[model samples]
Target: MLQTLDIEHRLKSTLDEFVADWGLDAEITAETWLVEDLGFDSIDVIQFIVAVETAFDKRNVGFQELIMQDGRYVDDLSVGQMATFLEARLPAA
Candidate 1:
């Protein structure tokens, strides 16, 4: 697996790629709200979901784990939290 610190870099790169793909300049930080802060609607979320799935070749696990009631956690996932999730779930290096 990637080093824990490296995960943040990876997340930033992934977010950068996603933004570039979508022609968006909205900054995505660990604290950025995907909806309120970034203005990501359902289609944007779905596109980001697809990008994340493709990043790890892990299908759509993020969305899969989120039911309708997941609420803010879905948009408020921090870099650290995403790192933890990816470390546990992604294939070992």
Candidate 2:
């Protein structure tokens, strides 16, 4: 199984690529907020989700549960939060 730190590092790398691909001028870290820091909209979030899935070589990681609560989309998410969620769902490696 991948350790928590491993997942965080990998996720951060993926985010770095996403930021570059979008031509975003920002530094990514565990505390970086997707919406507040990156200025990501809903469509951007969906695209990022796909990018993350491709980077990790996995799909259906239940991002809905992470992005939604009480039938409403959450306002924002930090990189660390996403790493934790992905760590739990990704299979052993």
Candidate 3:
């Protein structure tokens, strides 16, 4: 099974690729927020979701559960939060 730190590192690398494609210069860290720190809008967030799913080769991992709360979309998400969520869903490596 992959360790938590391994998951985080891979996730961060995926995020770095996404940021580069978007031409953003900000550094991605565990504490970096998608909306607040990266200034991602709704479309950007959707694109980011696609990037993450493609990176992990997961399309039905229930990302809605992580992005939604109380039947509403979340305001923001941190890189660490995303890594934790993916870690739970990804198969053993």
Candidate 4:
């Protein structure tokens, strides 16, 4: 298991790099919105995923897995959530 600090750092780093590639500006604590803040739809999601995959060199990740909107959630989340998900799923070398 990854330490909480390590996980958060990795997540934030990935998010920052990805956002930069898209010419988006966001703080580490910024909450990334899907359709509103980031203006991202399905295609954008794929693009972001691909970007992240390359940056982290992780395998292709699915959309549904990162769209964690339940348990009092509804339909969306910030990029942090996605990063956290990816960090957890990273394959151990």
lDDT values, one for every candidate:
0.63, 0.90, 0.85, 0.61
Off by over 4 Å in 3: 21-23
RMSD of 2: 1.3
lDDT of 4 by residue, 4-86 (tens): 45655765676566667667664555365665776677676666667666766666555455654463323555666765675
Question: TM-score of the candidate numbered 3?
Answer: 0.89
**Model 4, 57: alpha-carbon shift in Å?**
0.6
Better of 1 and 3 by TM-score: 3
Error of 4 at 84 (Å): 2.8
Per-residue lDDT of model 3, residues 1-93, tens digit only = 567799788878988877776667788888989999888898888888898888877798788899999999999999899888888888897
Residue 13 of model 4 has an lDDT of: 79
TM-score of 4: 0.58
Q: Which lDDT tens digits does candidate 2 get at residues 1-93?
A: 578898888888988877786778887888999999999999989998998999889999999999999999999999999988988899998
Residue 86 of model 3, lDDT score: 84
Off by over 4 Å in 2: 21-23
Candidate 2: pairs in clash: none
The candidate that wins on lDDT is 2
The TM-score values for the models, in the order shown, are 0.64, 0.91, 0.89, 0.58
Q: Is candidate 2 or candidate 3 better by lDDT?
A: 2
Residue 69 in candidate 4, Cα distance off native in Å:
7.6
Q: After superposition on all CA atoms, what RMSD does each candidate show versus the true structure? A: 3.4, 1.3, 1.4, 4.1
lDDT of 4 at 47: 69
Q: Spell out the clash pairs found in candidate 3.
A: none
